[model samples]
Target: MARLVARRGRWFIILPPLLFLFVFFLIPFAFALKISFGEAALRIPPFTDLFGRGADGHLHWQASLANYRYLLTDDVYVVAVLYSLRTAFFATLMCLMVGYPMAYAMARATKSTQNILMMVIILPFWTSFLLRVYALESIIRDNGLLNAVLLQLGLIDHPLRMMHTTFAIYLGIVYSYLPFMVLPLYATLEKLDRTLLEAASDLGGRPWRAFFDVTLPLSMPGVIAGSMLVFIPAIGEYVIPALLGGPDNLMIGRVLWDEFFGNHDWPVASAVAIAFLVLLAGPIAIHQYYQVRQVEY
Candidate 1:
């Protein structure tokens, strides 16, 4: 009776989150999936229904795979998707490279110092994300603080073209997402067994060698977690790219927006979004697989 009661109690604790996921994520996904198979129509919802009563006085199912088919055939879709992927991959790489060292330093710091550094890392989150990106504009834009300072210092005769460039997009992604990478890495590094490193040192292993062989391998889970955290959202990022990037820097998010609002092609937009979600799931699945393996080991 106690065991059964405990089981029910556990489920009671879990039920709200399960219900939330079902209501929010799953339900919306179902709607999008249904719409992906729809055709754009001159109606209220602007898309054809999956089920309707026909003129023959019978209920009929209607669906079209034309949107998905068009996705494969469209050069714009392919180019946008490829660009988004490339941008996300490089941005994730940059975040990881910069964050790993910062996280390592934080982990190595004394407890009070660690607290200060952690606060510094987290302070940006207190401000609005969009506002932070806008703030970056003040530093990077022409006649902004950075260019002003550089001019004052005689570093360059002219204000460099910083805004509305691919470099700005990359900078935006890295700046915004760096904390996400650092936090996970710091968590993993903090909980690491220092005794193992000491053991390796006692065996006359070099610091760099120990880091490569022991620390890096042990920290793989955190690396993967932080990577996914940055990569997934960065790929689907609309606001930053739309604001910072030029016309040439077309991402999938922009493509989706133009398809939905610019072209008013609801079915194709739904298909693109669904396809994007499916693409994102691959990384998520890989992360879960590694997490399970880590737990098993």
Candidate 2:
């Protein structure tokens, strides 16, 4: 009786979040799936019904794989998917490159300095995210602060075309997502045992060699965690590309937005979203597989 009560109590604890996910995520996903299988319509809901009443009052069901078929056959969507993946991968690499150093510095700092550094890193979150992106836009624009300062310093006779380019998009992504990368790395590095480095040094290993031999391997979890944090959201980023990038930047997020709002093709938009979700699942599944293998080993 006591065991039964305990199990029931555990289930009660789990029930709220389960219900929340069902209500928010699962239900919306089901709707999207339904829409993905639907055809574009001229009417109110903007998609043809999957099920309808026939003239004879019998129930009729209709579903098409046309949208998925179109995705496979269309080159534009394929290109967009590739572009999004490429952009996200590069952005994640940039974030890692920049954040790893910052996190290492923070981890090496004294306790009070570490707290101050962490606060500085997190201070951006207090302001509006949109406002920050807009601020970046202002700084990177042709006649903006960056060019103005460069011109004032006599570094260049003409303003560089820094804005509305892939470089700007990358910069925005790295800036926005740098904190995600830093925090995870900091968490991992802070708990790292300093004695390992000392032991490596005792064996006559240089600082760089010791880092590669001891520190890097131990911090793999943080590297993976931070990469995922930056990569996943960067893959679906719409705003930065839209605002900071040019017409040449045909990312999947922008394509999805244009399909839904620009073309008013909800069915196609849903199909794009579904396909993107499938693409995202590959990385997550690989991560899970590796995690399970590590646990077993």
RMSD of each: 2.2, 2.5
Number of clashing pairs per prediction, in order: 0, 0
TM-score of each: 0.92, 0.93
Tell me the tens digit of each residue's lDDT in model 2 across 1-297: 999999889988999999999999889988999999999999998999999998999899999999999998999899999999999999999999999999999999999999999999989867777788999999989999999999999999999998888999999999998999999899899999999999999999999999998999999888998898889889999999999999989899999999988999999999999889988997777667756886999
In candidate 1, what are the lDDT values of residues 155-252, reduced to their tens digit? 99999999989899999999999999999999999999999999999999999999999999999879989999899889999988988888988999
Q: What is the lDDT of candidate 2?
A: 0.92
| True lDDT of residue 60, candidate 2 | 95
Clashing pairs in 1: none
Top candidate on lDDT is 1
